[model samples]
Target: MNLFELNQAYRELEERDDLDLETLKDTLDAIEGAREVKLDSLASWIEKNKMQIDWVTEKVKDLQAKKASLTNLNKSLQGYMTQSLDDAGIKELQTKNHILKPRNYKASVVVDSLDDLPEEFKQTKTEVTADKKELYKVLKDGQEVPGVHLKPNRGTVIK
Candidate 1:
């Protein structure tokens, strides 16, 4: 039976609080039979569509790899084109289908190490963070630090 029909049946069952043992058993048996039919239909549908699912999964992986390859190629070509334009003293090149020009971007600062910077040239930004791995190690060694505590977490494994 469909969900609506099953729900109506359940509602009828719920209203009859004085149902005899035989009547309750029959109702339960009907519900279980309907559930088994639904499960069988679902399993059959999945089996029929398994091949299409596998094909789509493979195509997605292939497209992702191709996208990564194209991205790398674009970066390489952009660098080479930029160098060629700079060397040839051409600022911009326009064609019917495309326009090639150099776009200026903000320069980025590269630092070797934060510790090597002199105090005067460096700005200090303090951020407090908990090192969970180190904390776990300390707790495992039977030691506790102030302001830190371990808590148990529970989860269900569905398999």
Candidate 2:
């Protein structure tokens, strides 16, 4: 049966707690059988798709490496072209297919030393975070910190 149907059956059985031992055993068996079938189907799907997934992963990695190489080559070529133009005492070059021009350098802040940083360029900001391990230690020591409390959590693990 499907997950929904299995859940509904389980809920019905839970609501009626006076079920006979034979009936309970049969219901347990059915649930186990359904779970086994679901597991098998999932395993089969993974087996079928694993090779294609690996291939796509490899392709993506290769493309990323190629893109990085191309980016580095482009940067080097651009630097060489700029140097050549500067050496030729030209600001712009025109060709049949392209025009090369140097863009103006942007202004940026450069700090020579932190101690020498201007007050006008400095700003203050506040950040807040909790240290869970420390907080747990304090709680375990029977001390309370304001605005901090622990709550019970629940989870399930399947094997």
**Model 2: what TM-score?**
0.45
lDDT tens readout by residue for model 1, 1-159: 677776566656656769898987776676744665544444544454576799999999999999999999999999999998889888899979989998778997899998998889888789999999999999879897999888888953322
Candidate 1 residue-wise lDDT at 115: 93
lDDT scores for all predictions?
0.77, 0.76
On the 0 to 100 scale, the lDDT of residue 3 in model 1 is 72
Q: Candidate 1 local accuracy as lDDT? A: 0.77
- Score every model by TM-score: 0.42, 0.45
After superposing candidate 1 on the true structure, give the runs of residues whose Cα lies further than 4 Å from its correct spot: 1-39, 108-159
Error at 83, model 2, angstroms: 1.6
- Runs off by more than 4 Å, candidate 2: 1-34, 43-69, 130-159
Scored by lDDT, model 2 comes in at 0.76
RMSD values for the candidates in order, in angstroms, are 12.1, 11.6
Residue pairs with backbone overlap in model 2: none
| Most TM-score-accurate candidate | 2
lDDT of 2 at 46: 49
